[model samples]
Target chain A: MASQPHSLSYVGCNFLRQRLVLSTLSGRPVKIRKIRAKEENPGLRDFEASFIRLIDKVTNGSRIEINQTGTTLYYQPGLLYGGVLEHDCSPHRSIGYYLESLLCLAPFMKHPLRIVLRGVTNDQVDPSVDVLKATALPLLKKFGIDGEGFELKITRRGMPPKGGGEVIFACPVRKVLRPIQSTDPGKIKRIRGTAYSVRVSPQIANRIVDSARSILNKFIPDIYIYTDHMKGTSSGKSPGFGLSLVAETTNGTFLGAELASNPQGQGTAVLPEELGLNCAKLLLEEIYRGGCVDSTNQSLVLLLMTLGQQDVSKVLLGPLSPYTIEFLRHLRSFFQIMFKIETKPSHEELQGGEKVLMTCVGIGFSNLSKTIK
Target chain B: ASESESDRKGIQNAPEKNVDGVEWAESKAVEDEDGGGDVENLLKEEEEYGEENDFSADTAGALKWKEDLTQKAAEAFLRQQQSAPNLRKLVYGTVAEDADEEDDADEELGGLFHVSRPDKESKQKANALDCSKFPVETPQDWDLDEVMNSIRDCFVTGKWEA
Candidate 1:
C-alpha cells in the first residue's frame, strides 16, 4: 500500500488540496513544507486541518503527518476506497472548499462516492453548491460519467459564520473517462436560477427574483428565477438570503454566478434587490468569458480530460484563472501531461473576452482498484 | 504639494517624446495578442485566426525567396516550442530551485529565536484561503452602449451572422 514510484515535493500551502488530490489520484507521495512558517503561530490552520481530515475519511490506508508546529505536511496517498462518508466542514471556509476536490476524486474511486457534507453551503468565499449543481454536473456528463447515482442535493441551506447547511453529494465511479471536444459554446437559450431566503422575509425572495428578471429580460424572455425560502431545521442555523443564477446555452453549456448576503453580522447588509441585480450582471460577465465549461469547473474538466482514455481531448475556455493555472502546473508534476495552450482571440463582435484553446491527449489513467460488478 | 511632487515624478518616468505612445500602444496591442485581450477592441470588431497545427510542421516554410535557412528553421521550431514547454520540467524543475528561496524568510534573532517577515506577499499568498471562484478583474459596465452591444450576439434576441 505504501509503494510509490516517485515523491513529488511542493512548497507552501496555497495549493495543498490540488496537490493532495492529484497525488491520491495518481498514487504518488507528496511532501508540502513551509506552511505559514513565517507566521507567529505557524502551521496549518483549522480549516486546512478539517480539509485533510475530510480527505482521510474518503480514502483508506492513507498516511498523513504534520510537524509539531504544523509547518509541514507529508502525505502518502492510498487507494480511493470511497464509500459512505459524512464530514462536518469547518466554518472558517465554506463547504465548496472541500467539494471542489471531491468532484475530482469521486469519479476514479473504487466505489461510488456518497457523502453528506455539513457546512456553509452558500458564502462569498467559494462557489456555492447550487452553482456547482447547475454548472458542474452537466460539465461532468460531457465526459461520460453520468449514471443514476450522480446527483448533488442540498437538503439544508446553510450560511456562515455558524453554518448548519447539509448537502448530499453522490457520484458513480468510472473505469475510464471518455475524451471530449467542446470547442463552441452556443448562444444562451434561457436563464434559470434559485433565489433562496432562509429565516428571512419570504417576500425578499420575490424582490430578488423580480430585480434579476428585470436585468435579464433585455436578452431573453425565458428567464425564470425560483424563490425558495426554507424553514425550521432545513433553513440552517443562521438567517441569510442569496441568489444562484445559471444561463443555459443551446449547445448545453452552463455559465453560473451567485451572491450570498454578508453572513449575519460580518459586513454591510446587502439589499435583496441589489443582490439579485448584481448576481445577474455577474452571470453576464461569465457569458462574456464564454466557454463550454464555466470558470469554476475548468480544473475539474481538465483533470478528467487528463485521466481519459489516451485520446485527444480539446476544450475552449475563457481566460484561465489563477487557480487553474496552478492546477495545470501540478498536473504536469503528477501525471506528466502538459496541455497545448493556444490563445483564441474573440472573433465575433461584442463577445465577452478572449478565449483559451487547450488541447491534450489523455494518459489513459484507468481505475485499477474498482471491483467489477 | 504632495500631489505636485507625484506629478513631477510621473513626468520624469514618462517615455521620451520620440517614442510615439500611439505606435507603442499598437505594438503592445500586437504583443498582447499572444496572451491578454484588449477589452476596448471588442468594438473595433475582431480578427479571425485559423491555425492548422497538424499540417504546419511538414508543409510549412516551402519558400525559395527566403534567406538564412538556419534562422528560419530555428524561428519555426521556437514558435512550436513556445506553445508547450517541457511541461514536466517546467513544474518540477523550478520547484527544486524554489526550495532555496523558502529558507530566506527565517531571520534568526540572537542565534536562537527566529524572526518572521510579514512584508513578504508570497508568504501571505502561500497561506491564503483556497477557493475556486475567480472574480472578474474588470467587470464591463452593463449600462454602456458599446459594452451592451459586445455581448448582444450571445443572447437569442441578438442578430446572428452567417
Candidate 2:
C-alpha cells in the first residue's frame, strides 16, 4: 500500500515550514509550502465572500485561466460553487471548504487534483437544502464532474440544545480537470422593414371601398350637351353650332377642361378636348404626398376633361396628340368616374338647360375626382 | 251485637301501652337475630335502589374495551444480522483484521504522512457509499487518537454514516 504524503515540519523553534501535498490521479504528488507566523497559524482569508462576488461577475461568455508548471487550465462559463471553510489541527493540519470553490475554479483546472471537503451542521436551524438540491446536480453535469468523486458530508457539530453548521465539498472525478464550455447561444437575429404583415379588417376595407366609389361618382356625371338638329339628309351637313364648356377635377388640385363642338350638318356632333394637363398636375400632387401614381388613370382623366369641352356639331375623326393619347391611356384605369352623355333631336329647345347640365357635370366631376384622388 | 262479640273475644283488650322508655319495637328486638323483622327487608330494598340508580358499568366496560384494543395492537420489529457470502465473509475477516492493525500503525505513521493526502479512488469510493451505511457509534475503547484518525479518514474520504 502506498503511504500518505508526509506532513510539514519545523527543524528549529524559530523556523516553521508548512507543506501542502496535492496528489494527481496518476499518483504523482505536487508539494507546496507556505511560511506563517510562529505564534499563530494562517487562517483562511475572506475567500468565500470574494468568491461569491467573482462568480456573480461571470456571465454566459466569461472565462478564467490559470497557469501551473507551464500548463494552462481553462474554465469556461458554467456553474459556480459557494460554501464555508473548516479547519482541523490535531495530529496534522487540514483545511475544509465547500465544493463550490471547485466549481467556480473548474474552468482553470487543466491538471486539477481530485479533492474532497467535509463538514457537519453547526446549528439546529433548518438546512438550506434547496440550494444544494437546485445547483448540485446541474453543476455536476455542466462541469462533467463524476458523481462518485463529488462528496457532501453534513453532521451535527455541537452538543444538544445548540446548533452546528453544515460542510459541503465538491471534487472533480478525474485527476486532470477537463475543459468546459457554455451551452447557451448568445444573441438573437434582427429583422428589417415592418417585421410583420398586418391584415386589413373588414370594417376598414368597407370604408375604403365606399370612399373610393363616392369620389369616383363626384368626378364624373351623365348629361346631354345638346338636344336639337337641322341637317341635309343627302350631304349630312349641319350648321355651325357653339361648343359646350365643361370642367372636371384631376388629382386633388387641378381642373380638367372640356369642349363640345358641332359638326357641319343638321344634326349636331360633339367633340371634347382632352384634359392631359390637369391629370399631370394631379398625378404630381399624389407623388409629392408619397402615394403611388397610376399614370394610366391620370392620362384618362386628362382626356375626358379636354374632350368634354368640344363643340357638339364637330366630328373628331383623327387621333389627338401622342402626348394626349399617352396621358389618356395612363389615366384610363385610375379614374373613379365614368362619363355618360345622351343627345336627342327635338323641335323644342330648353333655354340654357344645356349650360346648366354642363355646369352640374363640371361641379360633380370636380367633387368626385377630388374625393377619389 | 258487634260490641258484645268484641268484649267476649278480647275482654276489652288492655289499653295500649307506650314504648317510649325502650325505643321502638324494632330497636328493642335488635339483639335477637330475627327480632328486627323488617330492618333486614329495608336494607335489602335500599341496596336494590342503589343498583338501579348507579350507571358506571357502561363507562367501565368502554374503558376496558379500549384497553383490550390497545393491548392487541399489531407490532413488527426488524433485526439485522451479519450474514455475508462466503467470499465476502473471508474478505471481511481478513480486511477487518488488517484494518485494525493498520489503524494502530497509522498512529506511528502520522508524523510521516499528511492526513489530507488525496486518494482519488478511495475518495471516489467514499463519495459513492451511501451516507447511511456506516452509522456513528461510540467505540468500546475511547482513544482520542484513534477517534481523531477515524474522523480524519472520513473527512479525507468524504464518507460518514449516522
Candidate 3:
C-alpha cells in the first residue's frame, strides 16, 4: 500500500453500518456529518454507537472520533484483527443487525471470528437469527466458507424491549473468496420452519405450526414446522412468539419469511394462528419473487461477489431492494465495481415474478491480514 | 387489439397512406391476400366449413381473445418489453447522485442564510431507519386461485417440461 486512499464523505445517519463496513473493508477513511442534527434529540443513536464499538473490537489500532453533539463521525480503519470475543449488542436493535455486518468482515479477518452476540434475536424489524441460520449459512457455504468451525448457534430466545437473548457466531478466515455463477433456481422441494415461543404457552407453537402447514401444504407434501419452546432461563425477558419459514429449492437456494408477535405492551397481542397465516402468505410472496437469492441477503451476496477472485460472478436475484441499490452505489465508490443488471421477465409459464441477473467481475480482494501458513 | 395494430402500421406506412386513405387500406388488404392466399388455397374446404360454423355469438363470447391468441399475446408482450425503462440506467443514473449534490448545495445555502432547508422527503430518507427486510408491499391475495396458480410451477410438484 503506497498511500492512504482519500476518505469518502456522506451525510445523515441512515446506512451508517454500510458506510463503516465498506470503509473498513476498503481501508479508507470516512467522514459522516449531520446525523439527525436537526432532530430534537440529535446525535448518534445507541445502536449506532454500539455498532462502532463492535467494529473497534474486531479491528486493531483503528481511530474513530465523534463530535461533541455526536452529529459528526470520522473513522480511519485498521487491519481486521479477528479473534474470540463477545459483544453486548444494543437492545434497541436486534443482534441480527450486527451479525449481518460481521458476516461480511468475518472471512477477511486476521484470525477466525468467534463472537457471542447477546441481544434481541427475533423482532418485528430486521432478519431473525433463525432465518439467517437457515439461509445465509448456506449462501456462505456456496462461496467455500465452510468447515466444522463455521456455525451460528442461538443459545437463547429473545424478543424486543427488554432483550436477554444470546448467540454464538463463528467463521473461518479465507485468503480469497471463490467466484460463483448461480443462475438457475430450481423448484422448491420442501418447506422447513420453526415456530418459537418464549415465556408463552407451549400450545401457541403447535397452533402456529398447524396454521402455517395448512397454507403451505397446498404446494408440497414435504412440510415440517418445528415447535421450539424455551423454558425458564433460556427464554428471554419478553413473552412473545414468532414463526420463521424457509423454502428449500432443489438447487440449494433458500428463501425465508418470518413474522413475530408485537413486543410485550407495545401493540395489540397477536394470535398464533393469525401470525402463522400471515407468515405463510409472506413466504408465498417470497416464492412469487423467485430468485436464486432472496431479498434480505441480496446485499450480502453482492458484497461477496465484489470481493471474490478476479473472475465474473453472476447471480440471479429478485428485484433489487432499496438497501441493495444503495449498496451498489457504495460498492462503486469503494471498489469501483459496477454490475451488468439485466431484467429477466418470467417468459416461462407460472414461474412467478420477474428476476434480475446481476453480473460483475471481482476486484480480486484477498485477505492480506490472514497469516500465511 | 386489431384496431391498435392497424393504427400502428398506418403510422409507420404513412407515405403509402398519403395517396388515399382508402387506397392505403386496399394496399394492406392486397398484402394480406398475397401472404394468406397460398395457405387459404390449401385449406379452402376446411376454411369454408369453419366460416359456416362461425356463429355471430361465438365472436362476442368470452373466448373471443382466442382468435389469433398467440400473435396478440406476442405483440402485447413486445409492447410491454419496449416500454419498460432500462433498469441498469435507473440504478446507476445520475439522478441519485444529483440528489446528493442538491442536498449539499442546499446545505451550503443554509450555511450562508443561517437557516435550515425544510426538504422533508429527502431529509427523512437521509435519516431513515436501516433494516434489511424488503417487506411485501401490496401482498397478493393468496386465497384467490388465480394468485395461487401464478406461482404453481415454482414448486416441484408442478408440471415439468421434458
Comparing to the true complex, what docking class would candidate 3 get? medium
Better of 2 and 3 by TM-score: 3
- Chain B only: TM-score of model 3: 0.47
Lowest lDDT 10-residue stretch of candidate 1 chain A? A1-10
Expressed as tens digits, the lDDT of each residue in B3-76 for candidate 1 is: 56545533533442223335436644564233223223321221111121222233223332222232343344
Per-prediction DockQ, in order?
A: 0.32, 0.00, 0.52
Residue-level lDDT of model 2, residues A229-267, one tens digit each, is: 222231111122111112111211111111112222323
Compute the lDDT for candidate 1: 0.82
Candidate 2 has a DockQ of 0.00
Model 3 Cα lDDT, one tens digit per residue, A53-157: 999999998999999999999999989999999999999999999999999999999999999999999999999999999999999999989999999999998
TM-score of each: 0.81, 0.16, 0.85
CA deviation > 4 Å runs, candidate 2: A1-34, A38-137, A146-179, A183-373, B1-162
Order the candidate numbers by lDDT, best to worst: 3, 1, 2
Q: Please give the CA lDDT of all the candidate structures.
A: 0.82, 0.24, 0.87
lDDT of 2: 0.24
What's the residue-level lDDT of A319 in candidate 1?
Answer: 81
Poorly placed runs, candidate 1 (over 4 Å): A1-3, B1-119
Question: Model 3 misses residue A265 by how many Å?
Answer: 0.8
lDDT of 3 by residue, B81-129 (tens): 4555457666776435467667666565434563456878777888899
Q: For residue B10, what is the lDDT in candidate 3?
A: 42
